[model samples]
Target: MARIGITGHSNLTAASAPLVREALVTQLSLHHDRLIGVTCLARGADQIFARAVLDVGGSFEVVLPAADYRDRKVKPDNAAAFDELIGKASQVRTMPFEESNRDAYMAASEHVLSSVDAMLAVWDGRPSGGRGGTGDVVQAARERGIPVTVVWPEGAERE
Candidate 1:
């Protein structure tokens, strides 16, 4: 199976969600039947990608930054969607941490990059805001010689 990992903006605007989802589904369709998506399943891009993967008849592997990542990082509004996606994931991996932190996030990011055959980044072409941001993961993927596909449709903005 072909494993494709996802990393992208956590604060994507609502207006861009559908656009991103459609583009992602279209891209993943090229892989046909042998597709497995790996993602951290955070809000925004992660959730969007998971939906696209499932829509394309692909399984998903969720990587949590910490054991209590959802409790610590997921907001009440996004909890339902997050929970639904988690329930649909074929596998769930949690980092060796009690709570969400920079180290845990980086570890999770590295795990995704190392486990996938390729990576899909839904970025706005900006530099990463911090260590475990999309830009950092995309750079790491490229340096490791993994193919990286960047998806940022015109007019897609962050929330």
Candidate 2:
């Protein structure tokens, strides 16, 4: 079984979503029935990855950045998708923080990294805009000797 974690841009361009989703599906298919996706369930890339996992008949786990992540971090426009994915997760883990700050996000990413075999990053090779962004997660995974696959499709772009 392969337990793969995900980190990516949350503001992907409209056209990039399908491209990223296709790439995720292709990658996840390699593991087939044994795939287990781990994600923070953020909008854009995280949600796309979760859907791809399910489409590939793979189960997934979620790592919430904080207790209030759903209420505080998820925007109204994305709440439905966030809740749906949460309900479908095989397991859900929440960080110890009450607020969804940068520290909490980083801690949650670290938690995901600790349990996964590899990391799938949907980054465009740019440095992270914040402390717990895709780049940071990818770097952390590499530092821990976990293999990381960058999955920015040819036409993928950030908003």
Candidate 3:
């Protein structure tokens, strides 16, 4: 079994979703079976990764930044997907925070990086949005000597 973690853009546009999904699924296919995908279940990349994991007969382990992260951060349009993915997670780990914040997000990112064998980042090869963003997580994973694969197919655009 291979344990893979994901971090990526949260503002991916509708038109770019399929390209990201296809690229992600193709990369994950190399692992064959018994895949364990660890993610924060955020919108965009996280949700897409979770779906790919399920489609490939893999399990999901969700690491939430806060207890009420979904309600506080997830938009109404994406709430259903976030909720459904979280509900289907094989394991749910919430950081020790009541609300979503920078510290909580960092802690969750640390947990994902530390627990996974490798990380799949659906990044745009740009700087992070802020602390605990895709760039930060990828850097931390690299520092920890974990393999970090960047997945950004051409023509992928963010909203």
Candidate 4:
């Protein structure tokens, strides 16, 4: 079993989000019952990934950049979902932070990436907002010799 890391746009849904989620879950399920840890922050891809981890009967973990549950005040929906995931997770780690400095981002990423045997990155073809370049995180995992899987949605042709 491999521990997979998940990430994607926090606001995407329907056409985009579900497709990416499908691709990720498909690949992760291949790990069979050995699938152990699934790590995620708290946001769009994070929420979707959490649900998928539960559906697959795999272990899930959340590593937050905030101190504790207090960050909820800034993200009611995300906070609620994060809390819900916490209940479902086999393990949860909180690294007090505000998502403002590089230190926090690195710490959060470190926990999420290090916990698992591999990383699953959901890509929508662009840089994410304030969460640092997810591409960088994926690459970092590679540098650590962790396997990385990607879920990319086929964008509709432009008019």
Give per-residue CA lDDT, model 1, range 1-159, as digits (tens): 889999999898899999999989988998965899999999999999999999999999999999889889999999999999999999999989998988898899999999999999999889988888899999999999999999998879998
lDDT of 3 by residue, 4-41 (tens): 99999989989999999999999999997699999999
TM per model? 0.98, 0.97, 0.97, 0.80
Residue 57 displacement (Å), model 2: 0.4
Q: Which pairs of residues clash in candidate 3, taking residues 3 or more apart in a chain or in different chains?
A: none
lDDT of each: 0.93, 0.93, 0.92, 0.66
lDDT value, residue 109 of candidate 1: 93
Query: So what's the TM-score on candidate 2?
Result: 0.97
Candidate 3 deviant stretches above 4 angstroms: none
- Tens digits of lDDT, candidate 4, 61-87: 777666643454338646666667778
RMSD after Cα superposition, model 4: 3.4
Write candidate 2's Cα lDDT for 79-140 as tens digits. 99899999999999898999999999899999999999988999999998889988999999
Candidate 4 Cα errors over 4 Å, as ranges? 68-74, 96-100, 125-131, 155-159
Q: Give the worst 10-residue stretch by lDDT in candidate 1.
A: 25-34
